[model samples]
Target chain A: MSGIELKNVTKRYKENKFEITALENVSVQVKAGEFVAIVGPSGSGKSTFLSIAGALLKPTEGSIMINNQNITDFDEKQLSSVRLNQIGFILQTANLIPYLTVLDQLLIVKKMQGTVTKEDKAFALELLKDLGLENKEKKYPNECSGGERQRVAIARSFMNDPDIILADEPTSSLDTDRGHEVVQQMAEQVKTRNKAAIMVTHDERMLSYCDRVYRIVDGKLSEEVRTQEV
Target chain B: MGLALKELLYSKGRFIMIGLIIVLISWLVFILSGLGTGLSTLSTGVLSEAEYSGIVLEEGSEFSLSKSSVNRSLTEKVSEQEGVTDTTPMSIFRNSVRKEGAEDAEDKITDIVLIGLEPDSFMEPNIIKGEAWSNSDENQVIADESLENDGYKIGDTVVLDNTDKELTIVGFTENKTLYHQSALYLPMENFQNLRPSSPDDADVEETVSGIVVQGTDVNLETFLEDEENVEYGTKEETIEGIPGYVAENATIMLMLWFLMIISAFILGVFFYVLTNQKTNQFGVLKAIGGSNGFIIRSVISQVFILSLVSILVGIGLTYLTVLALPESMPFYLESNMVIIYSLVLLAISVLSSLFSVAKITKIDPLTALGRAE
Candidate 1:
C-alpha cells in the first residue's frame, strides 16, 4: 500500500496546436524492494513515464498514487514536498553540482529538507560508504571517475531514504565495465534499502539485474517476462 | 551554512571581478560626494563659524550681502522688536593686499575679504594668535590663519590697494573664510576709513550691508515680513543664496544619482549572466527537491555580502586617500552623508540581484531529467 502505483496514466503534449499523445493509458505498479526496468527505443514514452512517476510532470489524464494518496492532483508546493520526501531521481550523467564535494552533494539534499543535523551527516557518510565512496567524500565531481561520479549520484538519491527511487538512463555515459558497476550499485542499494525503484534504460544488457521488464513501443506499454540469473 | 557563500568561495576568481567593479564604483561615489561637500562648504565657511537667528538683508537684494545697504539705524528698531536679543551692523569688501616685506607684483597680491563689524558683537571671530581688534584700536585687523600660510605674520603691516590705510595684523583667527577667501576682521571705523564709499553705494547717512540677527526665527521672519525694506534668511538659505552655489551642487548631485543608478544596472547584468551560466546546476537542484525559495535566498545573500564588503573597502580607500591630500584641497566628507549614501549603494546592489532571482524561478527541473553534463 505504501508504494508507487500508476493507474492508466496518459500524457499529451500540445505543440503549436498539434495534440500529440506521448503516453497511452500506461499503468505500472512497483512495490517495495522491487527493481523494475523500463526498456524502450527512441521516442517511446520512457522519459514521459519516468517524469510522471517522479512527480516532475503531471499526466494529462490519470491518477498517480503513492502511499494510497493521489498526488496527480497535488498543487506545486505539495508536489515539491512529495518529490522531496517520497521520490528520488538519478538522472543521466550523474549531474553533480560542480562546486560541491561528494559528501556535500549528499548533505545538500538534507539541507533542502530543513537543516542538516549531525545524524544526517552520519547517514550521508554511511550511504557513501555503502556505494564505496568513503575516500571520495572530499573530492569534487570532476575529480571522480565516470563510474565513481554515478555512484555518488546514487548515494545522493538514497540520502533522503525515500520510499521509491527513479532513475532515467542511469548508465548512459559509462562504459561496459563502469556501466555494470553503476547499474549494479543502483540495484544493490535498492534491494538493501527495501525501497521500490524504477529505471528507464535502452541498454538491453543492463536488464538482467531487474526483477521485471516492461517494453514501450510508440507510446504503448507491455510487460515482457524474461529468464535471467541475478 | 549558505550555499551562496560556499559557491562564492569556491569560485573566488569569478566573484572577485564583480566585487572589484563594485569597489571601484563605491570609491568614485565617495570621492565625488566628498568634493561636492567640499565645494559647498568652501562658500559657507564663515557662516558656519557663527550662530544666528537670521541674516537680515534688503528685500530685493537677492540675498547678496553687498546689495543690502540698510540704514545703520535699522538695527535699533529691530533690537526694540519682540524676540530680538541683539543686532549688529556689518559691511564687507573684497580687497587685494600686500605683506609689508613681500614684492608688490600682481602674483604676490593676496585676495582677502575685509569684514568691518562691531568688535563687541557676537560676529567677532575668536582671536587665536594675538588680541582682538577693539573699536579703539586704529588699523588693527585680525587676519584668518590661512594668511599665515601665505607668509603674512601677526603684527605685520598689510597695505590696501588704492588707499593709504595700512592695517597692522593684530591677531589671527582660524577657519573664517568668506566666499572661499580669507576673512580679515577689522573695527568698523578703521574699515570705513580704508573705503572711499560704501560698496553698496548707500546715502551719506550711516549705512550697513546687512544686520546680523540673533533672536528667534519666527520673530525675525514675521517682523521682517511687515518691513518693506528688509527680509530674513536662515543659515541654510544664506548658504544657498551664494552665487553659483546651487548650480554647482545640483550638477554634482545629479551625477551622483546617475552613478548610483548605473552601478545598479551593471550589478544586475553581472548577476544575470552568472545565473544563466549556472542554470544546469539550479535545474539539478530543483529536480532533487531544492525549493525556489532556497535558491533565491542564496542569490540575494551572495549579492549582499559581496556589495557590503566592497563598499567597506572603498570607504577605507577613501579615508586613506584623504590623508594623502593637502589641506588646501576643498574636500570634505560629512559623516551623515557617508552613512546614507553607503546604505543606498548596498540596497541598490541587493535589489539589482532580483534579476537573477527571476531567472532562477523560471528554471524547470524537467530540464535536468534527460540531459548530460
Candidate 2:
C-alpha cells in the first residue's frame, strides 16, 4: 500500500511587495516500505515540498492523499491530528528540547495528545535501544554528544510509530561515517516498520541507501523514468 | 503542565528574576495601598462613622467645619422642618492645652483643635474611654490617644489657658484626630467661651460652628439658604467642606492607580521578552504536532503561577509592616471591603499574563521547518 500521494501540488507565499512561487505542479508517491530521497540545492523549493507533505504548510493548490484520505482539505485541527498520528519529521538540526532528558524528549509528543500508555513507553524504549541510546535516556540534551543527540532525535521522530517519516536534512551536521550510519538507521526503520521514509538532503552520497531518488529543480520533482518502475 | 514546570526549573535563573520583579513591585503597591487607607482614616475617621443622612454647610462656600457656621437659633429652626430627626450643634475652634505637670510643661501646651459638641451628638460615637463630653461646667474634656504620652487619665485636669475655667481629661478616643492636629472634644459652650478676642472686647455669645442633622428633609436646605441667621449643608456637602480632605485624597489615589497600571504593563512586557526567546522551542513543539492551544496553556499557566506566588509574598510583607505600627500613630488598618479589593488588584497581574500567551497563537508552524538551523 502507498503511504503518501502528492498530485499536482503548488505552494506560494505572497509578501507585502512580491509573490514568491515556492513549489509548482509537483507530484510524487511512496509505497509503505520505500525509502525515497529528495535532492535539491538551497533555493530549489525542496524544503517547501517537504513542509507541504508533512502537513506543516498548506498547499496553494492541488491535493495530498495520506493513508488513502485526501488531506489538503483538513482544517487546522484535523491536519494536526494527521501529523500527530501519521507523520514523523526530522529537521536540519537535532532540534532536541534542551531542557528535556533524552527519555522525556520522546514522551512529550505522546503526553501532549494524551497520557503515555505502557505500550507507548515500551515502543519508545525499543526505538531508543535500536538507535544505540539505550543507556543515555536519562541525560539532558546538552550532556549528549552531537551524534548522540541526533540519534535521540531520530528515536523521538518515530516514537508515535508514525506511518511516514519526513527528514529535511537528517545528516547535514554529521561527519561522513556518522552521516552514513544515520542514513542506514533511517533505511532500516523504513523496511522494518513497513513505513515510507522521504529524506530531503543535499548530500548525494546518501542516495544509494534510498529505494528511489529524485531531484527537485526550479519548482518541480523529476527523476529518470527507468527508476520509477521500481 | 509538567513539561512547563521542568522547563522553568531548567532555566530557573530567568523565571526567578521575573518573579523577583513581580514581588518587589507588588510589595510597593501593597504598602502604598495600606498607607493611603491609613492616612485617609486619620483625616476623616470621625466623619466616616457618623452615619448622618446629610451634612449642612454654606451653599456658596467650600464646605469646611471651620468655614461653615450656623447659630444655635438656626439649628432650632431647622429642627422644625419635616423629616428632621435630630440636630446637634458643633463648634470647631483652635486652642492650646497642657498637662498640669510635665518636664517641658510649656512645650506640653500643644496646639489642638477643640471640636465642641452638644452633650450627645451623632458625630462623637467612637469614644473608646471614660465617657462623651458633658454640658456641665465641671470642665470635662475627651482627648484622642495622641495625648496618651501626657498620661492624662480620666479625672486628670488640663488647662485650656489663662481662663479661670479648667478642663478635666475625661476619656481617650481612637482615630478622631483631624489632619495634623489632635482633636479634643468639649462642650459647645466651653468652645464658644474659649474663642479668641481683642483684649478689651466683650465675650462672644455661645454659638455652634455647624449643625449635624439626620433624615432626608429637603426643605431645611432651602430654609437655611434663605434664612439670614445661619448656614446649613447636607452630609455630602459637609464631607466636601473638610479642609483639603477631598483634593489630597484624590491626588494620592490617582498616584496609586497609575502605579498599578505601570506594573501591569511591565509584567506584560517581561513575559513578551521571555516568549520571544523561546520561539524556536515553540516551533520544535509545533513540528512534533503540538497544538497552539497546548503551548499557550503552558505559557499562561506559568505566568499565573508566578504572579500568585508574588502576590502572596507582597501581602505577607505588607501585613507585617502594618502590624508593627504603634497605636498612637493615628493610622488605621481597615478590615472590610479593602481585602477583596486588594485581591482584585493581584488578580489583574495574573490576568495580564494572557497578553503574552496570545502572542504564541500567531506563530506559524511552517517556521519550525525552515526556521530550524
Candidate 3:
C-alpha cells in the first residue's frame, strides 16, 4: 500500500484519427520491498505502462496511487511533484548526465526540490559507498565505465528516498557480467531499503533478481508464473 | 544553481570560448560607447558643460560664432527679455601664439584659441590650477592644461602673431575646447584690445562676437524673433553647428547600435543552441522529477553569470585600453556611461537566454521516459 499501484490503466494514441491502444486495462500493484520485472518484446506497451506508472504520462482511464494517494486527477505540475518526491527513475544505458560528477549525480536529485543539505550529501556519499562507488565520487560520467555509470545512476535514483524506483532497461548498455551486477545492485537496494521497484527489461538473464515477472504481449498485461531455466 | 555551476565548471572549454566571444563583443561595445562619448564631449563640452543654455549670433554670420560680431549693449536688452535669466557678452578669436623669448624657429608653436568672457561668468571653465581671472581691463589668461604637453607653462607670457601684445598665462584649466582646438580663457576687455585684426577706429570695449544667453528656448526664440541681425540656438543645436561633430557622431553611434544588436543576436543564438545541445539532458532531468522551474533557473543562472562576468571583464578591458592610449586622442569615458552601457549589455544577454528557457518549458519529460543513455 505504501508503494505504487496502477488500477486498470489504459493509454491510447490517436494516429491519424484512428486510435491505437498502447496499454489496455493493465492492473499492477508493486508494494514496499517488492522487485517487479515487466518483460516484453520491442513495442509491447512496456514503456507506456512504465510512463503511466511513473506519472510521466497520464492514462486515458483508471487511476494511479503512490503511497495510497490517488494521482490520476493530479495536474501536470502536481504530476511532476509526484515524480520528484515519490518516484525514482533509472533509464536505459545509465542515462547519466554527462557534465555531472558521480557524487553530483546523486546530489542533483536532492537539489531539484530545494537546497541540498549536508545530511543529503552524506547520504549520497553513503549510497555511493554502499554501491561500490568509493573513490569515484569526483569522477564524471564519461570517466566511469558503463557498469560504474549505471551503478551511479542506481545510486542517484535512490538519492531522493522515493517510495517507488522505476528502471527502464538500466542494464541494456552493459555486457552480461556488468548487466547482472547493475541489476543485482538494484534488487539489493530495493529489498534492503524497503522500496518498491519495477524494472522493464527484455533480457531474460536479469529476471532472476525480480520477485515477480509480468509479460506484455501486444497491449495486454498478465502475470507469468515464476519459472526456472531450461 | 548547483547544476548550473557544475555544468559550467565541467565544460570549461565550451563556455569559455563562448564567454571569450562575449568579452570581445562587450569590449567593442564599451570602446565604441567611449569613443562616441569622447567625440561628443570634445566637440560640445564647452557648450554643454557650461551653465547657459544657448547663444546669440549675428544672423548674417549663419551660426558661425567666429564671424559673428554684435554690439555689447545688446547684452542688457537680451537680459530684459521674458524668461531671460542672464547674459554675458563674449568673443572667440582664432590665433597663433608663442611663448616669450622663443626663437623664430619656435614662432606659431601653439595654435591658441582665446575665449573672452567675464572672469567669473558661467561660461568660464573651472580652472584646475593657478588663479581665476581678476580684472576685465588687464591682460590675463587661463590656458587649457593641454598646453602643458606643448611646453607652455602657467605664469609664462604669451605673444600673439602680427602684434606685440603680451597676455600672461595666469592659470590652467581642464576640458575647454572649441572647434577641436584648445582654448585659453581671458577677460573681454583684454580680448578686445589684443585681437590682431581689430580696426584702429573701432570701439573695442563696445563690441562682442556673441552673447551667451541663458533661458527657456521658447522665450529665447521669441526674443530672437523681435531682434535684428541675430539668431538664437540651444547648446545642443549649437553643438550640431560645430564642424564634423554631427557626422562623426552619427557614424560612430550607428556602428555602436549595430554592434549591440548583433551582439544580442549572437548571444541569444548561442544560448539557444546551447539549450538545444542539452535538450536530451534537460528532458532526462524533467523525467526523473526535475521540474521546469528548476531547469529554467539553472539555465538563467548560467547565462546571467556568464554575461555578468564577461561584461565586467569587458569594461575592465575598456578602461585598461583607455589608459594605454596616448593623451592626445579624443577619448573620454565617463563613469555613468560605463555603468549604463554595462547594465544594458548585461540585461540583453540575460534576456537572450529566455528563448532557451522557452525551449526548456516545451521539453516533454516523456521524451526522457526511455531515452537511450
Candidate 4:
C-alpha cells in the first residue's frame, strides 16, 4: 500500500483515427522492499508500461496509486511534484547531464527540490561512496566509463529517497559482469532502503537479481516464476 | 542559476565564442552611436547655442541662412511689434582666412565661417579673453576658441579672402563653431563690404541674411503672412533644416538599429540551435521532476549572464577606444546614452532566449523513457 499500484491500466494511441493499444488492462502492485522486473522483446510495450508507471505518461483509462493516493486525476504541475518527490528514475543510456560532475548529478535533485542542505550534501557523498564512485565525484560524465556512468545514475536516483524506483533498461549498455553487478546493487538498495523498484529490461540475465519477474507479449503482462528469494 | 552558470563554465569555448561575437557587434553599435552624436553636435551646435526664440528668413530660401536676404528695415518693424522684445540682423557666409605673412596659395588658406553681427547685440558671444567688439571697425574681429588650434592668437593678423583686407583678432570665445568650421565674428559694416551683391538685386538697399528674434508671445503665422517674401520658424526647426543634418542622423541611427536587431537575431538563432541539440537532455530533466519554470529560468539566466558580461566588455572596449582617439576625431559618447544602449542590449538578449524557452516547454518527457513508437 505504501508503494506503487496500477489497476486496470490501458494505454491507447490514436493517429488519424487509427487506434493502437500500447498497454491492455495491466494490473500490478509493487510493494515496499520488493524488486520487480518486466521483460519483453522489442516493441512489446515494456517501455510504455514503465513510462506510465513512472507518471511520465498517463494511461487512457486506469488508476495509479502511490502511497495510497490516486494520481490519475492530477494536473501536470501536481504530476511533476509527484515525480520529483516520490518517483526515482534510472533511464536507459545513462542519462547523466553531460555538463555536471558525478557528485553534481546527485545534488541536482536536491537543487530542483529547493531543499539543498548540509545533510543533503553528506547523503549525496555517502551515496557516491556506497556506489563505489567516491573518487570519481569530480569527474564529468564524459570522463567516466559506461559502467561508471550507470552507477552515477543509480546514485542520483537514490538521492531524493523516493517511494518508488523505475528503471528502463538501466544495464542495456553495460557488459555482462558490470550489468549483473549494477542490478545486484539496485536490488540491495531496494531491500535495504525499503523502497519499491520496477525494472523494465529485455536482458534475461538480469532476472536472477529480481524477487519476481513479469513477461509482456503483445501488450499483455503476465507474472512469471520467481527467480530469486526476497 | 547555479546549473546555468555551471553549464556555461563547463562549455567555455562555445559560450565564449558566442559571447565574443556579441562583443564585436556591441562595440560597433556603441562606436556608431558616438559618431552619430558627434556629427549632430557638429552640424547644429551654433544654432543650438544661440539665445533666440525664432529666426525669420526670406521666403523660398528653404530656411537656409546663406540663401536668405532680409531687408535691414525689417529689424525696426519687428522690434516694435507686439510681444517682440528684440530683433537683430545677422549674416553667415563661408570664407577662407590666411595668416598675415602667408603666401597667396590655396593650401595656405584655412576654411572658416564668418558671422557678421551688430556690436553689443544679443548675438555677441561672451568673450573668454581680450576685449569685446568696440566699434564697426573693418580691421578687428573676434575668433572662436577653435582658432587657437590653428596657432592664431589674440592680436594675430589674418587676411580675409577676396577683400584684400587684413584684420587683427581682438577676442576669443568658446563653443562658437558653424558647420564644423571655426567661426570669425565681424562687425556689420565689415559684413556689408564683404557680402556678395546679387545681380538681380541691383536696386535693393543693404540686406542682411536673417533676423534673430527673442520673446515668444507674437503670432508667428500672422506676422509672416503680413510681411511679403518672409518666412519664420523656431530656432530648433531652423537647425533641423541644415543640409545633411536629418539624413546623416537618420543613416547612422538606421545602422545602429540594424546592428542591434541583427545581434538579437544572432543570439536567437544560436540559442535555438543549442536548445535543439539538448532536447533529449531537457526531456530527461523534465521526466526527473524539473518544472517548466525552472528550465525556463535557467535558460534565461544563462542568456542574461552572457549578455551582461559581453556587453560590459564591449562598452569597456569602446571607452578605451574613445580615450585613445585624437581630439580631432568626431566621436562623442555620453554616459547616459551608453547606459541606455546597454539596457536595450540586455532586454534584447532576454527576448532572444524566448525561442529556446518555447522549445523547452514543449519537450515531451516521455521521449526520455526511450519508448518505441
Candidate 5:
C-alpha cells in the first residue's frame, strides 16, 4: 500500500544573498487510494512541498515515511532507488525524451533500473491501453498532441508500478476541457489501482475531481476534507 | 541502452554535425600524418633499408651521410676493429650528367648524388637490374630507377660534368635515391676518379668521403673518432644525423600532437554545449532516480560512438588518398606507420572526450528542475 506520512517537515532555500522559507512545519498524511490535490497560488510553496514528498528535494528537517520506511535519512543513491522503486513523478510539462518512441520511453526507464521483463512490457501495454494510447506506442513524443503527450507522461509515471504518484501541475498547458479530462483520468486510475496520488496545481477548476483538496499560502497548508456530492 | 541510441537517432542534425566535425578533424590528422611519413621516407630512402648497423661519422658532426667525410685510411682503421667484417670506401658528389650523343640536348644534365660504392658492398640490396660496378675505365654506373624513368638506358653514356669522363649506365635500383635527387652507384676506384668533385691536393688516392662498415663486435665508431680521426654512427643515430630529419619530424609531430589537443577541446566544447542544453532533462531524470553514473555513462557512450565512426571514416579516407597517390609522388604507406598513427588518433579522440566528462560531472542535477527555458 502507498501511504505517505509527513511529520513536522520544514524546508528553506538558503542562498549567499538571502533566505526564503518554502515550507514551514508542514504535517500531512495521505492514505493509500487517496486522490489528494494541493492547491495554491504562485510562490505558495506547493511545488516545494510536493518536491520534498517525492524525494526530489530533501527537507531541511523532517521524516518522510512512505509505506512505513523513513526516507529522509537515505543517501543520494538510496533516495534515487526509492524514487525508482516506490515513487512516480509527473511534471507540468510532459518532459518526455523526444528521441524515444512512446513504447521506448517506458522501456528506457525500465532499462535504467536494470532489466525489463516480459511482464513489464505487458503491464506497459496495459497502461497504454488504459490511457487510450495503445495505438501510439511506436510514435515519438514530438508526433503526439499535447493531451496525448500528457497521457503518455502519465503512463510513463506508472510504468514502474510505483505505490505513490506525485504530479506537479500535470495539465497546466492544456485547455480547460483537456485539463479536466487529464485530471479525471488520473483520478480514475488512482482509485482503480488503489494507489496514493498527490497533485500540486494552481488551477482551482480541476480540484473537484480529487478526493481531498488542500491550499498552501505563505509557507503553510490549510486542508479541506470534503466529498464531491454532485 | 536503446534510449541513448534512440536519442542520437532522433536529433540527426545535431549528431550529424558533431560527426561531420569529427570526420573532418580525423581526415586532417590522417592526411598530415601520411604526408609527414612520406616526406620522412623520401629524406631517408637510401639509409632506411641499409644493411649497415652504423655509419662511422666524425664525432660532434652534424651531417652523417650527406656532409660527413673520412679518409680511405680511416676505412682501413674501421675494418681493423674486432666486429668489423668488412669496410667499403664511399664517396658522394653532386654533378649533372648528359647523354653523350643527344643531338636535341639543350644541356640535358640532371644533378645526381654519385655514391661510389664497392663492387661487393653489403649496402646494395635492392639492385633491380644489371650487375654491380667493376674496376673499369669504360664508365659503369648503377643509376636509381628514377634516372631510368628520365630516359637513361643501360648502354647510355652519361658525361660527368666538369670532366671528360663519360660513364655508361650498367644497372638500376629501386628507391635508392636520396632526398629529391637520383643516386648513381659506381665502383669505389672508378667513383673516386670519375665523379666530378674538387680534387684532394693531399693524398688524393687515400682520400674518401665516407666508409660503410659491416660487423658489430667492436666500437668502430670510437676507433674512428680516436684512432683514425673519423666520424662514426649507428644506423638510427645516422638517421637522426640526416639533414632535416630531426627538425622536420619534430615540427610535423608537434603539429599533429597539437591538432589532437585541439580535437579534445572541440569535442569538449561540443559536449559542454550539448549537456548544457539538456540540463533540464538531466534534472528531470535525476529527480526520477537516474544516477549520476548513468548519465555519465550515456554521455560517454555517445562520444565513444561518435569517435569510433569518425576515426573509421578518417582512416578510410586516408587509405583512399594513399592508394590514389602517384607512385612517383614519394608518398609511402607503411602498415606499422598506419597502425601507430591510427592509435595516436584514437588516443587523441578519447582524450578529447574526457573534457566532456569533466563538464558533465560538474553539472548539478538539481539545475535540471530549476527554471529552464
Candidate 6:
C-alpha cells in the first residue's frame, strides 16, 4: 500500500467486432526500497502492465492502489494529480524535452508542481553530480550523449521524490556498457532512497541490476527466479 | 509560459518567419485603409469644409451639387423654418483659369471649380495669406494655394474660360479642392455672369445651385416633409452621395475586410500545423501529469506574445512608410483608425489560437506511453 499494488488487473481493446485482451487478471506488488524489472518480448503486454501500474492506463476489470488509495476510478484530472505527486515516468529513448538543458530537464518537473525552491535547485544539482553529469548541466539533450541523456532523465524522475517510479525501456537506445551503467545508477538510487521502481525492458543483460524480475508472455505475468546477486 | 518563451527564443528562425508574414499582412491593410480615406477626401474636401448642418438640393438632382438648382425664394423659406438659424445660397461650377495674357491652350489652362458664396457667409474661405474679398465684386476671387504652382500671386489677373472677364486674385487659401480640381472662391453675382442662365428661365436673380443651412437640432425628415421638391441631407450623407463615392468606398473596404479575414485563417492554419507537428510532444507532457489547462495556457501565451510583438513591428513598418511617402500623394491614416484595426487584428489572432488549444486537449496520454496500437 505504501508503494504500488495491482489486484486482478485486466486491459482489453475492442477493434471493430473482435475484442483483444492485452492484459488478463494480472496482479503485482512492489514495496518501498525494491527494484523490480519486467522483461518480455515485443507485444507480450509488458508495456500494458507498466502503464496500468503507473496509472497512465485504466484497468478494464480491476483496481489499482497506490499508497492505499484506490485509483482505478479516479477521473483524468485526479489521475494526473496522482501521477504528478506519487508516480514518476522514465519513458523510452531518454525522453528529455529537446529545448531543455540537462539541469532544466530536472528543474522542469519541480516547476510543473509549482514547488521550485533554492533547495530544490541544490538537490537537482546534487543529483546530477551523483549521476556523473555535473559538468553537463547546461548541455541540451541534443548536445549530450545517449548515456548522459538517460542519466538526466533518471535525475528528472527523482526530482519530485515520488513514491513510485515507472521506467519503460530506459536502456533501449544505449550501448551495452552504457546501458548497464545507467541501470546501476538507477538501482543505487532506488535502494539508497527507499523508493519503489518498476522497469520494463527486453534486455536480459540489465536484469542482474534489479532485485526482482518478472516475465509477461501473451497477456499473462509470471515472476522469474533470480540466479545472480544484485 | 516559461516553456513557451524558451522555445520561441531557441527557435528564432521559425518564429521570425511567422512574424514577417504578420508584418506583410498588417502593412497591406494599413496602406489600403489610408488610400481609401484619401480617395474619399479628394472627392468631398470642399463640401466637408462647408461644415453645414444640412444641405438642400432639388429632389431629382441625385445629390450632385453641380446639377442642383434652387431659387432665391426657397433660400428665404428655409431660413424661416423652425430651428433654421442661418442659410447660405452657393453655386459650384467647373471652369478653367489661365494667366491673363496667356493663350487658351491646354498647357496654359488649369481646371478649377468656381465656388460662389456670399462675401461673409459660412462658406467663405479661411484666407491664409492676403485679404478676403470685401464685397461681391465681379472681378475679384480667392484662389486655392495650388494655384501658386501656376505663377499666380496676389493682385494677379486670371481670365475666366468662355468669358472675356478677367478676375484679380485677392487672397490665397489652403489646399481646397472638389472632385480632384482646385477651387476658386467667387461672389454669387460673378459666378452667375460667367455662366449662361438656365435655358428655361431668363431671370438671373432667380438662380442658385443649392442652399447650405446651419441650425440646432435640424431634423432632416421634417425638413424634407416641409419642402415639396427638395431633398435634405447631413454633410456626411451629402459627401457619401457624390458620384462613385459609395461604390469606391465599398469596394476598397470589402477587399480590406476580406484580407483581414484571410489573415486570420492563415494564422489559424499556421498555428494548427505547428500544434500538429508537436502532438507527440504534447502527448508526452500529458502522460507525465501535465494538465490540459497547463498545456493550453502555454499555447495561448505563446500566441499572445507572438501577436503583440509582430503587430507592433507591423505598425512600426507602417509608420516608416508614412514618413517615406511623398507630400503630393493622397494617403491619410488616422491614429484612432489604426488603433482600432490593431485591436481587431489582435482579437482575431487570439481567437485563431483557440484551434491549437482545442487540439492539445484531445491528445491522449496513452499514445505517448506506447500502450495504444
Best by TM-score: 1
lDDT by residue for model 2 (B1-373), tens: 8787888889889888988888788777777766776677667655655777665554454667777655566677677777888877777876777766543644567667788887767776577878766546776788877776555678877777655346887888976666656778877766676676566643345345667777764467567657764555666666656777788779878987898788888887888888888888888888889888888888877777777777777777767877787655544546553465457656666677777777777777777776465
What is the DockQ of the complex in model 5? 0.52
How does each model score on lDDT?
Answer: 0.86, 0.78, 0.85, 0.86, 0.78, 0.84
Residue B90 alpha-carbon offset, candidate 2, angstroms: 4.9
The interface root-mean-square deviation of each model, in the order shown, is 1.0, 1.2, 1.1, 2.0, 1.8, 2.4
Return the clash pairs for model 6, or none.
Answer: none
Q: For residues A1-230, write the lDDT of model 4, one tens digit per residue.
A: 79999999999989798998989999999999999999999988898899889988889999999999999898888999898899999999889898999989899899999968999999999988888888899999999998899888888888889999999899899999999988888888889899999999999989888888999987899998764564
A107-154, model 6: which lDDT tens digit per residue? 878877886799999999999999999889999889999999888888
CA lDDT for candidate 2 = 0.78
Query: For residue B29, what is the lDDT in candidate 2?
Result: 74
In angstroms, how far off is B288's CA in candidate 2? 2.6
Residue B155 error, candidate 5, Å: 6.5
Off by over 4 Å in 6: A114-123, A227-229, B48-53, B71-90, B106-108, B116-158, B164-176, B185-217, B220-224, B323-329, B371-373
- Native contact recovery (fnat) for each candidate is 0.74, 0.70, 0.80, 0.72, 0.50, 0.43
lDDT of 1 by residue, B54-122 (tens): 677888888778667677778887787777798888888888788764554644888888898987898
State the lDDT at B168 in candidate 6. Answer: 88
TM-score of chain A of each: 0.97, 0.94, 0.97, 0.97, 0.96, 0.97
lDDT of 5 by residue, B1-373 (tens): 4556777888989999988888888888878877887677767767776777677665456546667666677766677787878777777777778888653557578888788877777876366887666546766888888787787888788877778578888888877766667888887777777644455566666666667777765475467446545666777887787777889889989998898788878877887788778877777777777777787788777777777787788879878887887666766566676677667766665666676666665665455345445
Q: Write the residue-wise lDDT of candidate 3 on A1-230 in tens digits.
A: 69989999889999998999999999999999999999999899999998999898899998999999999999889999988888998988777899898988888888898888999999999999989999999998889999998899899889999999999988888999999999998899999999999999999999989999999989799999855732
Candidate 5 clashes between residue pairs 3 or more apart in a chain or in different chains: B55-B233, B56-B231, B56-B232, B57-B231, B57-B232, B58-B231, B264-B352
Model 1, A1-230: lDDT tens digits are 87899999999999998998999999999999999999999799999999899998999988899978899888777887888888888989999998888999999999899999999999999998988988899999989998998999899999888999999898899898888888898899999999999999999989888999999998899999666556
As a TM-score, model 1 comes out at 0.89
| Better structure of 3 and 4 per DockQ | 3
Between prediction 2 and prediction 6, the one with superior TM-score is 6
- In the predicted model 3, the residue pairs found to clash are none
- lDDT by residue (tens digit), candidate 4, B1-373: 9999999999999999989988988899899999888777667656766788888899988887877888877887778766778888888888888898776464468788888888778988888989776756546888987787778899999988777578789999866777778788888878777766677976344688888888867656666768999998678778777777889889999989998999889989998998888888888888899999988888899989999999999999999999987766677687898999999999998899898988898999887886321
Each predicted complex: what DockQ? 0.72, 0.59, 0.69, 0.55, 0.52, 0.44
